[model samples]
Target: MTIGLDMMGGDFAPLEAVKGLQLYLSEPGAPANIFLLGDEAILRPLLATHMIPEDRIRVVHAPEVIGMHEHPTKALKEKQQSSIAVGFYLLSQGKIDAFISAGNTGAMLVGAHYSLKTIEGVMRPTISTIIPREDGRTGLLLDVGLNADCKPEHLNQFAVLGSLYARHILGIQQPRVGLINIGEEEGKGNILAQASYPLLKENNRIHFIGNVEGRDVLADKADVMVCEGFTGNIILKLAESFYEMTHRHSIRHEYLDRFNFEHYGGTPVLGINKPVIIGHGISRAPAFKNMLKLAAKMVKSDLFDQMQIAFRN
Candidate 1:
């Protein structure tokens, strides 16, 4: 499998991205070939410095770069030669099995939507974060920052998507799906939640548990938590702050350390035709390495094919 990396996307740009490639290469049994997308002049020297095997790495020169603050749709349209755009083009053309970037997230989303498009039955594509549970196990949360506003049908689909990801990517079997709400009781949330509960319950594709309250997010109450992007994004940001707060106070603990976004590398834009991972803007070398690892797993799992089958059935 070939995985594409946007060498110029993140805040650190080519340097950190090249460092990430070094880290990934150093790992034992690292799967998939890497296609680095960026300026050839910069990347070539970095690759030589890092000693990445030429056979395992391919460089695609894209001189243009979409800035972090640029509008997603506009940048993609105007900057056809940009790294992000080139990455998407390669992905759409099947030259790469997955595309990853720590740079402009909006551009990645816009590229995925317009270039590869969504799965046939998917109403809208969703992005999800890996939730580090209080226990040793991990969970999945969906619509983290995509589709802030959603319908009941959208939540139901998110449950399916999140569940498949949990099972295939996260190695959770029969992952339990939960609707995030204010209370655990059945009729407890707004119209969306109330409307979504039955769909989740009746859907045989996933193991749907009852409503999961805020307190349950860190616990094992649910393996896959589904919510609109607005609530999920708030929860995500709040969770991120916990790690920052702990660092500020110089408190070190195993559980708290799991909150580091770098550990997971990036969040994958689920429901797209191909795997597209969006890394944090401030992602460093370790984060990039993890993103590639995750991308490799997603491609190996045939995740999008599974989604198409699930949605079709």
Candidate 2:
């Protein structure tokens, strides 16, 4: 399998991306062939300086880059030669199995929607973050920042999507699904929560465990937490800050380390026809390595095929 990487997407640009390649290639039985998308003039020297194996990778020179602050739609349309644009183009044409980028997230999302098809029964594709549980196990939370405003049906669909991810990617069988809400009881919380409760409970595609409050997020009460992006995004930001603030103060702990976003590499856009992993803007070598590992697993496991089957039913 050939995987594409946007070498110009992150804050550290080509350097960190090249280092990430070094890390991945150093591993025993490296996962897949890599396609580096960026300026050839800059990437070639770094690849040589870093001693990256030329046989395992190919470089696709993209002379342009999309800035973090640029509008997603406009940048993609105007910067046809940008790394992000070219990566998506390769993915759409089946030249690559998956795409990874730590760059402009808006551009990544826009590109995925336009370049790839959503699963047949999926209403919308969602992004999810890994939740580090207190019990040493991990969970999944969906629509983290994708759909801020969602209807009851959207949450219901997210439940199915999140469950599939947890099962295939996280290796959790019969994953328990939970609705993020203000209270544990039925008919509690906002109109969306109330309306979504029955739908989740009735969805046979997932194993629903009723409502899970904010406290349950870290308690391992649920394996797959479902909510609209607005609430989920707040939870995600809060979790991220916990790590940042604690690390900044020199607080050290194993649990705190688990909160680091680099450990998981990046978030993959679910419900799309192909795998597209989005990394943190500050991702480094470790994050990039893990992202490639994730992409390999997703492609090998036939995860999307299972998702298509589940949604069709």
Pull out the clashing pairs in model 1.
Answer: 9-103
Model 1 residue 280 CA deviation (Å) reads 0.6
Write one digit per residue (lDDT tens) for candidate 2, span 1-313: 9999999988988899899989999999877999999999999999999999999999999999999999999999999999999999999999999999999999999999999999999998999999887898889999899999999999999999899898899999999999999998999999999999999999998999999999999897999999999999999889889888999999999867888867888999999999999999999989898999999899888689989998886
Model 2, which residues run further than 4 Å from truth?
Answer: none
lDDT of 1 by residue, 1-313 (tens): 9999999989998899999989998899999899999999988988998898999999999999999999999989999999999999999999999999998999999999988978889999999999888887889999998999999999999999999899889988899898999988899999999999999999989899899989999898899999999999999989888898999999998778888867889999999889999999999999999999999999999677899999885
Q: Mark the regions of model 1 whose C-alpha exceeds 4 Å error after superposition.
A: none
**What TM-score does model 2 achieve against the real structure?**
0.98
What does each candidate score in C-alpha RMSD? 1.0, 0.8
C-alpha lDDT (0 to 100) for residue 309 of candidate 2: 94
